[model samples]
Target: MLRYEMQGGIWVYPGKGGWHFITLPTDVAARIKAAMAGLARPWGSLGVTAVIGKTKWTTSLFPDKTTGSLLLPVKASVRQSERLKAGDAPIVTIEIAL
Candidate 1:
């Protein structure tokens, strides 16, 4: 397993019913790709366990081709529970099982 801890701002996808996400740091993204790219699911997503504040959930890290990074989706429930919103910088922990 591999674990990463990072701080990033939440942003909403620019579209109707915009989805929220936090983009992993470039350094972290590079490391994750080097270690787990082969294990990624379809569309270059990897299963991961994510934690923020006191909330934890099973989710996936999705590839962001333009940025060459991974984006972690922050679901509505988790966001509300964590008191997070767009533009808020939050520390996030992600664990990937090999």
Candidate 2:
């Protein structure tokens, strides 16, 4: 298992109820690509357990071609639980298992 903790700002997608996301740092994304690229699922999504504040959930991290980073989707439930909104920067912990 590998664990990473980082802080990033949340952003909302333009349409379709506005999906929220947090982009992983470029360095961290590169590290993950090196270590876990073979473990990725379809669309380059990697399974992970994410925690923000006291809220935790299982989800997938998707690679972003535009930014060369990884994107973590922040579900509405988790956002409500963590009291987070788009534009807020929060410390998040993600655990990946092999």
Candidate 3:
């Protein structure tokens, strides 16, 4: 099962990108259930760039210890948004193990 966090006026989503709630009207809970499935896809996870976005302007994941892989740069527009700087505040917490 997926969780839909009711944020702002509309339903915001989890991860670093995309709208949170496709549309979970109160009347029919079934629709919300369907939307949750879509939101929970493997593609729904925060991309590699997003992971790096979580810890920028601070330090690297391996400071003074370089790795072969390189993280993508956060787009200027995204850097200006809440999710990139709000830690996990803007993300709807999902309970995947449950």
Candidate 2: segments with Cα more than 4 A from true spot: none
Decreasing TM-score order of the candidates: 2, 1, 3
lDDT of 2 at 67: 98
Q: Rate the local accuracy (lDDT) of all candidates.
A: 0.92, 0.92, 0.28
lDDT of 3 by residue, 31-98 (tens): 33334444332423311112222433221111111222111223335445534432323322222212
Better TM-score candidate (1, 2):
2
TM-score of predicted model 1?
Answer: 0.95
Q: Which 10-residue window of candidate 2 scores lowest in summed lDDT?
A: 29-38
- Model 3 lDDT, full chain set: 0.28
Clashes of each: 0, 0, 2
Model 2 per-residue lDDT tens digits across residues 32-94: 778786898999898899999999899999999999999999999999998899999999998
Residue pairs in clash, model 1: none
Local error of candidate 1 at 66, Å?
Answer: 1.6
**Model 3 TM-score relative to the real fold:** 0.20
The positional error of residue 76 in candidate 3, measured at the CA in angstroms, is 2.6
Model 3 / residue 42 / CA error / Å: 30
Worst 10 residues of 1 by lDDT: 32-41
| Local error of candidate 3 at residue 3 (angstroms) | 22
